[model samples]
Target: MKRFPAAAALLAAVLLLAGCSASGSSNDAGSSVSNPGTGAVTGDGTTKDSGVVGAPQAGDAAGSVTSGSAAGSTSEVATGQRDVIMTGSMSITAKDPIKATQDAVTITEQAGGRIDSRTENPATENQQASATLTLRIPSGALDRTVTDLKKLGTVNFVSLNASDITQQTQDLDARITALKTSVDRLLTLMQQATTTTDLIAIEGTLSQRQADLESLQSQRNFLSDQVDFSTITLSLYSTGTVAPGAPGDFWTAIGAGWAALVGALGAALVGIGYALPWIALVGVLALIVILIVRMSRRKGKAA
Candidate 1:
């Protein structure tokens, strides 16, 4: 009976040990699954836990960060860019220079622009004048302004020009954006700066960035103003009166002859009038001499 009991206890102990071993094996597998650093799950039910920081969060969704940043940079560049140069010219014949200039000024104002300068002078005719005006017409209204200028008088000449500055404008805009980004980074560094030298250096960089930003802003503003307006040069010409002698070849010759004859007769009359005083003096002297000669001869004969 004692032997039987001892054998039964031994068998139970073996089974318990086996159960504990199996439980321990299951626990170890679960621990390995929980700690991905120690294990991995492959695509085919195989788990592999890499210790390389989860592939760095997939590097910003496979270029999402870079693409977004590039898109933002492009948008800023577009807004900060420069504009193209536009120019136009017009010439017309006007009867009155002042009125033409006045009309040009009105047109420029209506077109959202201004007159830069103006000049006027008398033409070949007695009352005719010519005028020239330099005006800045809004880019959108340049064509309309030119058309209005033409309507002021008889059209003589017209021209227009457009110049592209896409490359230069894009380059400037990129530089400005890059500088702004650098300034932002520098500011962040300044916030974390502990040493005095580092702080001072960051301050200097910030100041430089501010100045550069202001300069870029000024340049952009000027460029915008220029691009938004088109320059137009308005010139007025006058038609002179017809010269009398230039017309009617045969009649002109006849009239010229008549004028010459009249001129000769007037000259002869002026000459006779000028000699009258001298002629009178000569006659009085001759009469006195004759009387003296006759009296002297009679005295001599009586003697």
Candidate 2:
């Protein structure tokens, strides 16, 4: 009877010990999972979880970090508000380039636009007067502005380029919104950060999210500016001045060939003019040498 009782007590102790060991292991696993800063966000804006971290814990407010510029692909812009950027270039020959440039500036300013840059070269002895003006005209008034500019001079060449960026705009807006949400969540977690390690981890993530948000905001602003303001590059020159890159016809080809022939003749004349002095000097030197040799031979024959 004594041996039976002792054996029962020993078996009960062993069972309790096993249960305690199991419980300790479970607690250890839970604590390890609760720790942060295992896998951080990579440079390309992807999240990598390190160790066995799962979703937001019981008291934690942050759920998961979202990537920058990778959110919301299905978003759409409003109808009729599609973002389109317009850029155009034109070449014109006018009676006067300076006056045309001034008129162009006035037209752009009147249409609620401005000049981005202007370059003017007064007619020199060797070159005709020319002006180049880069104007930013409001998108709504671009067509009218172009028409008005055409009146300033005779249009030689004109071209317009348009790019539709509505999808890109919507995508950027969505990314900004997502980044904002992520930052807000991180902020909340930062406030609740209980350990130094957790605080550091949250701070790093918050910084990254904030940086991404700012960058996206800047991009959105630039894109909006491009959509609102259409760019036009106007080139003006004197009426008699040849427009650069105007297509050539048969007559033009003949004129170019004639000019090339004239230029070659002129170059040959200049080269001959340079060589004439050297040729005279060599002829004079040869004549003196021949006279001295003849005189020496006569003296030898007489002796």
Candidate 3:
């Protein structure tokens, strides 16, 4: 009975040991499968953590950068200003064109403007005087100046035009900035170059960029000036009676008489020229008829 009990106890201990060994083997196989060739378990854990934490962080950084750039562009577009050029033409009838022209010049000067050009024709015996003026006025005071000028004479014609150059100006500004940056970079490169070939190449590029920048700047300045000042083409003509005793009245009268005489003589000559062909045809027919009648009489006498 004692041996039997001892054997049974040994059998139980063996079974328990076998079960523990199987469990350990299964765990080892699973660990090998999870981490294939890597030896460090800690490293695997660290890699897992970093992937979980770093992926969202990188995505967020990229998204933030993109959104910031978008916001900056939106703000720039929202704040972009427009450049406008204004021009006008006006025709006025006045009693005296010279006086009206002077008044227009004075008004332009008073409005912080200037006359770009002016022409006046004095009154003659038969024709009224006229004047044409090109004026530059402040854009802000264009309406007021035009109104004041209208008071000088009757408004025969008027035209106003406006052009928006915002896009053009913005494009020029961007080009200028880019060209300047290119020039600066080229200059820096030229300074750092050790070889003559490199220096010459960089210098050539730099000079081209600088010239482009200057041209863009000039265009921008011209656009800015057009925006600042408005142009006005004003024409004035006499509406009242012509003065008979003007300085050139005698010469004008003589010219008029000579023109009328020449016109009459030309008309008479044209009439004569048109009739000559018809007159020649009639004379030839008459001569033929006379010859035919004489030939008939001679034939009758011979018979």
The C-alpha local distance difference test score for the whole of candidate 1 amounts to 0.60
Note the residue pairs that clash in candidate 1. Answer: 39-49, 40-47, 40-48, 40-49, 41-46, 41-47, 41-48, 42-46, 42-47
lDDT by residue (tens digit), candidate 2, 1-303: 755554443333333323433343233223211221121211111121111124244222222322222222322232365789999999999898998999999999999999999999988745788999999999999999999999987899999999998776765654455456546645655564445555566566567557767887999999999999999999998977555544358887788779889999999999999999999999999999999999999999999
- Candidate 1 lDDT over 96-150, as tens digits, reads 7678788889888988899888998755423456788889988888877788888
Residue 251 of candidate 2: its Cα lDDT? 88
| Colliding residue pairs in candidate 2 | none
Give the whole-model CA lDDT for all candidates, comma-separated: 0.60, 0.66, 0.65
Query: What C-alpha lDDT does candidate 3 achieve relative to the native structure?
Result: 0.65
Q: Which parts of model 2 have CA positions greater than 4 angstroms off?
A: 1-78, 241-303
**Residues 1-303, candidate 3, lDDT per residue (tens digit)?**
755554443333333323433343244323321122121221212221222213224334333323443333345567864578999899999988899999999999999998889998998766789999999999989999999999998999899999987656655554444345435534544454555554554455456556656876998899988898899999998887746764457887798779889999999999999999999999999999999999999999999
Q: Which ranges in model 3 have alpha carbons more than 4 Å from their true place? A: 1-80, 243-303
Q: By TM-score, how accurate is candidate 3?
A: 0.57
Query: Measured by C-alpha RMSD in angstroms, how accurate is candidate 1?
Result: 30.6
TM-score, each model? 0.52, 0.57, 0.57
